[model samples]
Target: MTFSRVNAARGLTLAALLLAASGCGAKNTPADASRAEPDPLAKLQPAQDMAAYRAMSDLLYKLDQEAIQRELTETGQEKSTKPAKDKLFGFDATRAVHDRDFIASGEGKALADSLLTYQTPSGGWSKRTNMSTPRKPGQQFGTEKDYVPTFDNYATTTQFWVMANACNAHQDSRYCDSASRALSLILLAQYPNGGWPQSFPLRGKYHDDITFNDDAIANLLKVVGAAAEGDERLAFLSDGLKAQAKHSLVRALDMLVATQVEVDGEPTIWGAQHDDETLEPTSARAFEPVALATSESADLVLFLMTLKNPPENIRKAIDSANRWFEKHQIHGLRYRRGDELPALIPDDDADPLWARFYDIESDRPVFGDRDGQVYFELEKISAERRAGYGWYTERPYKALKEYRKWQQ
Candidate 1:
């Protein structure tokens, strides 16, 4: 569920292209037509607002670089302090409230109260905020100042689950009302194209992109599907609300099939994020370049596999992504988390590992640093990024395992 940043050189290229497109840069060179590689995403027509999206992405990249530079200039290096466990809060609280008895318990009531207090005016919860404590006056709903209400990191959806369960246990109008508002946020945040953004009330930059990073969109889809299917937790939803959930579910499913990344006219897996309108792969944070994201893609595949008697297109998409996983898995080495930095230890008997990002064209494992340099080897990136981010994952094995059973 970790998200990385992008390569700065690639950002410069994209910025240059934007400038050239706007007639603000020198052009008319015709010497290298033979050397230019055709764009793999050309067939997937860009959205009308693609230029704006790219411009914003470029701007964010620059701002990120500037911020990092400032920190390094002032402090000699970027600070890396891990927050205390009590300070780090997310879906774990909701996950622990599994039964009706727990929901009726005093501790559960306190948790529900804290969640209700923190629910933003827009009806969604913020990521990583300490929901164990009640909101203070004049405090932002989110833990981070810049982050608005979001579905990222199991935020709003998880709160919705907790509230719904609380409603079921106590028949409290407060819990039901809160859960309903959260559900409304889920339905409203989805783009007309049926993809969900990382954060809503449309916080521009990459936050406005159609996000799958940390399974943001995928998690929302699960909640929507559950509501549509009349899940007991959401039994309080009105028929009208349930119908809306059903329609949202249908559009999102179609979007899932349509947005699968393509290379050389063949569908591959998905990227961590996509253009909100174009549905083409796009970059997120500075180190998370536009590439085939194995971890997020595996989650999508698992979700698709859960569909009973899936249509031909859904089945095809699943099969194609599964094949992509099989084709791209790293072998003969295992990812090791070292005290100093992570390493790929040589072990022939080790299970296969998948890089978090694979180059869109070459399919080689890609690593990126806060400086925006993309490297083919993990050793090439900064030690800070190497130790901080999860650059490789074993998540795809679960998807492939499920696929084998699904085939049978």
Candidate 2:
């Protein structure tokens, strides 16, 4: 049934029950929840622009959802036999839809039903079907032709945020339970040094191949924020999220502090750190830091401010990060030390974060390398390859504009 239909029916059923209750168990009716209202989220219910927001959110949500469904179908039928190569992704689409209340009318739950079909025994989702099954242990590789699971930590993070948010809207415990398990996996996956590895098997096995940082931690933090404060898992929940933000922030800050190239006596963050092993900043590639550009740092700063008595250290760290951001933003974009010269990476290869940060103000979609090429490899690929690809095909300007609307 549609969301409105289900909700309306549920509402009427409970009302009829309350009317019939007379003197018995009236406390158990929907009125119980209603009396306990004053919902914290009432203000967030976009009454004024809600219709517009819902329409826009739904369009993107449906498009992304179709891709996710396609991936899930390709994973093979688990009830029969496992496909040789089975990978699943595209959860972000569900998440965006859920958060925007596209599911409020119930259509979103239908999409979510497909996702639940792929859940693993451990409560966490495997990137591909037949993943939980015993298999040879190593970095499994597969081509586009094969359904190899992509083992990125960000995928798990996205699942938590998506599922957790869904649970809130549906008032269903299953989504919350799934979210908790995914969150736990992330906590367990943290390295002794406090950073999360980029890929899965987040243990001693593939220590050599892990580097991409900020995005995963940012995603994790957003999911953790979705949890209710008084929930039973609050302690574990808060600790894990705070630890992620704290440690990861420190590591990121250290990198920024250590390697921010000095141009005209000002320190600036670079695009990607260059280290073959562990991908630390042994060298720097001059793609600009993008998130800080569109006031992303400001958003995080605001989120941090919402904490009741935020730790002094956390506040201090945010302050430092903010200062760096304020100093870095110029002509409405964050660039490497000497941005007057071309970026260190090719234009197409430019960091997406930069587009995100600036909301596509100046240099965006593709930041030009000294040689005038874009940093994104996808941009370099033939137009045929990138044509229908969701992310690659999304120009930075358009992506940022859509995101800005959502934030509103």
Q: lDDT tens digits, residues 16-88, model 1?
A: 5434332310111111111123221111111223343344334433432233244344445544222112333
- Residues 7-101 of candidate 2 have per-residue lDDT tens digits of 44544443343233222212212111121222111111111122322232233223223323333344442222333344445333544444647
Q: What stretches of model 2 exceed 4 Å from their correct place? A: 1-101, 104-106, 120-154, 171-173, 203-214, 225-279, 282-308, 332-408
Best by lDDT: 1
The superposed Cα distance between candidate 2 and the true structure at residue 2, in angstroms, equals 58
Misplaced by over 4 Å in model 1 are 1-91, 97-101
Worst 10 residues of 1 by lDDT: 25-34
C-alpha lDDT score of every prediction, in listed order: 0.71, 0.36
